[model samples]
Target: MTFKSINPANGEVIASFEEDADYALKIRLGEKSFDRWKNTGIEERIKLILNLAVILEARKAELAKEISLEMGKTLKSATAEIEKCAITAKYYCQIAEEQLGSIEVSNYAHKAYYKYEPQGGILAVMPWNFPYWQALRFAIPTILAGNVVLLKHAPNVFMSATTLEKLFIEAGFENGIFQNLLVGIDKIESIVADRFIKGVTLTGSNLAGSSLASLAGKYLKKSVLELGGSDPFVVLADANIESAATFAVKSRFQNAGQTCIAAKRWIVVDEVYEEFLNKVSEKINKLKAGDPFNTESDFGPVARLDLAEKIEGQINFLVKKGAKKLINGVRKGCLLTPTLLNMSRDLSHSFTEELFGPVACIITAKNTDEAIEIANETNFGLGASLWSQNLEEGEHLLQKLNAGSVYLNSMVKSDASMPFGGINQSGYGRELGVYGFYEFCNVKSYIIEK
Candidate 1:
């Protein structure tokens, strides 16, 4: 069987790649490559990553275009995603040596320290949205810390996957150091169970994360999962209403709203509910959803026909359950119109499921306490944003949110300098930052007595 890349903007097959028939050989190659890569100094890895960043910057336009063609994200957003990846690479390069250095436990009569060491090959199961950013976000730090990556990218974005693999090679990565395995789901278990594959890291749905985590556990391998999120953008009564409305539009609709950390739920207090809703709806109307290649377009397609269909179905279900459609949504092919739904607090129980599209749900709260209560109603606790002019109160309210990351007057986003992950059904384990570098490493304790 072959993995086909279908352009979501139009029903066109851009390319197809045959599944890796010799995965065992590839695993062996990863094993061999890891042996050498793990032995290489951090300084050497840093140099290569610096080169990789340079390549990413130089080919930003071309790479962004490929991303747009494969996944249907607007050219501008795709370019920004590529830019973020390159910045992340450079960030890791700057911090890797210090972060991976041995931590001095004690140094009296006996010297003692705990060091971060590489653990063979890591299998990365990445999703299609923000394809390059998601893969490199995990791979950069993990690889810099001395692990090889066997990436199993989403099938629809295989061109981006292969392009990344080629870019790794061009940046002087060994044949097996950063290999993209064009394999199906059936092939994952064996790869995870292999001796060379030390651990697994996945950025996808809760179901996928559960299955992969189960496999990793069955094989006694470590697993890190960054899964689905129904992140809340809480607009308190005291917030800068104008700014909150503007950012709410941006956070919900960016990447056509397929983001894991996007503000999926807008929990607005009663005081500013109508005002915030009106402003956001106006912004939504002004958005230009068109061809991914179009410079003038704000966003594009949903990445697949099924994804668009799924999103529409979810909207319909909510509407039937008495959710008021403040702004109607339209679906044509893979392009979905941005939607806004005013959800009754009684139906708060239904907020658990994620509608991965350019759709936003506003859940009204009587007050701040009710707002926090409504925010915590979901099974997903990925990330959230609390908008309030009172900095202290916002910080205090943030603590009540059940999410991995919480921001005050800002949209939830991933920064290379900060650790990013989620809690509850959003999945376990952390990615990005120094903590992420240690996720797939062996934190070995060393002691020497004279």
Candidate 2:
């Protein structure tokens, strides 16, 4: 099978490449390179990562263009994404030594410490929606910890994948230290079963996570999954309605609402529901949806036509089930206007489903307690943003929300300094921070007694 890198905005094929026919050879090369890479000094590894960061910074313009052309994100957003990758590389480079350093477990009598060791190759199944950021967030730390990487990126973003592989080599990494396998989903199981592949980490849908996780379990390999999300954006009566409304639009509409961390559901307390709705509706109307290459456009089209169709189908299904379309969204091929739907409280099933496009579902909550209840009524616990003027009360309410990360008076985001992942169907394990750096490491304990 051939993977075509098509521009989602205009449906033009930018490039195409045949699937990697010699996948076995690629895996073998990864196996050979693991020993050499793992044995390299941490200082040298950090130096190479810094070099990679420099290259990412220097070539960000061309790289961002490829990303925007392939994935339909605005050039500004794509440029920011590439810059974030570079910043994260530098972040890990600064902290890798301490994060990966050995820990002393015993202070008296006998010497005992816990040391982190790389466990060969890790297979990363990355998604296309923030293609560069998604792949590097996992790869940078995993590689810095001395493990080799085999990337199986989403087919639609194969061009970005190949470019990433080239960047690694340009930074002076050995051929197999980081390899991009162009094979499809069918080959994932075989790759996971390979002795050279020690673990698996995937950032995609729940269905994809389940299949690959089962394979990892069968092969006795450790796995980390960052899956889908229906994260809620809660607004209280006393909260800064204007600021909350502004950030809400930014969070829900950015990336054309394709992000896993994007706020999919909006739960506003009845006390300020009308005010919040009016502000958001007005803000949504002003959004400019146009060519991704245009600097003035606030957002671009959805990554593909099928994705737009799916969003449209989901909106239609909800409208049939008694959901009110407060602000109608117009769809043209891959471009979709920002939409707002006022959802009834009884629509429990739709609340659980993940909606991936630029449509925000608004649910009115009677009060703060009810708002919390509505926000927690989903299978996804990825992330949530709560707005309330009462900092103490909001801090206390944080314990009640069942999410991986909750933000007060701010939008939900994944930071290099924080652990990012979710609970329940949102998938387990984490990415970023110290926990992510140690996910694929062997935490071996060393002890000696005289």
Kindly report which residue stretches of model 2 are placed more than 4 angstroms away from their true locations once superposed: 107-109, 348-350
Q: Give the TM-score of candidate 1.
A: 0.99
Candidate 2 residue lDDT tens string, 1-450: 989988988899999989999998999999899879989999999999999999999999999999999999999999999999999999999999998988987577488899899999899999999999999999999999999999999999999999999999999998999999999999999999998889999999999999999999999999999999999899999999999999999999999999898888889999999999999999999999989999889999999888999999999999999899998999999999988999887894455678998999999999999999989988899999999999999999888899999999999999998999999999999999987789999999888899
Task: Write down the lDDT of every candidate, Cα atoms only.
Answer: 0.92, 0.93
Error of 1 at 175 (Å): 0.7
Q: How many clashing pairs per prediction, in order?
A: 0, 0
User: Where is model 1 poorest over a 10-residue stretch in terms of lDDT?
Assistant: 345-354
TM-score of 2: 0.99
The C-alpha stretches of model 1 lying farther than 4 A from their native spots are 107-109
Error of 2 at 355 (Å): 0.6
lDDT of 2 at 194: 93
Using all chains and alpha carbons, the TM-scores for the candidates as numbered come to 0.99, 0.99
RMSD of each: 1.0, 1.0
Can you list the residue pairs that collide in candidate 2? none
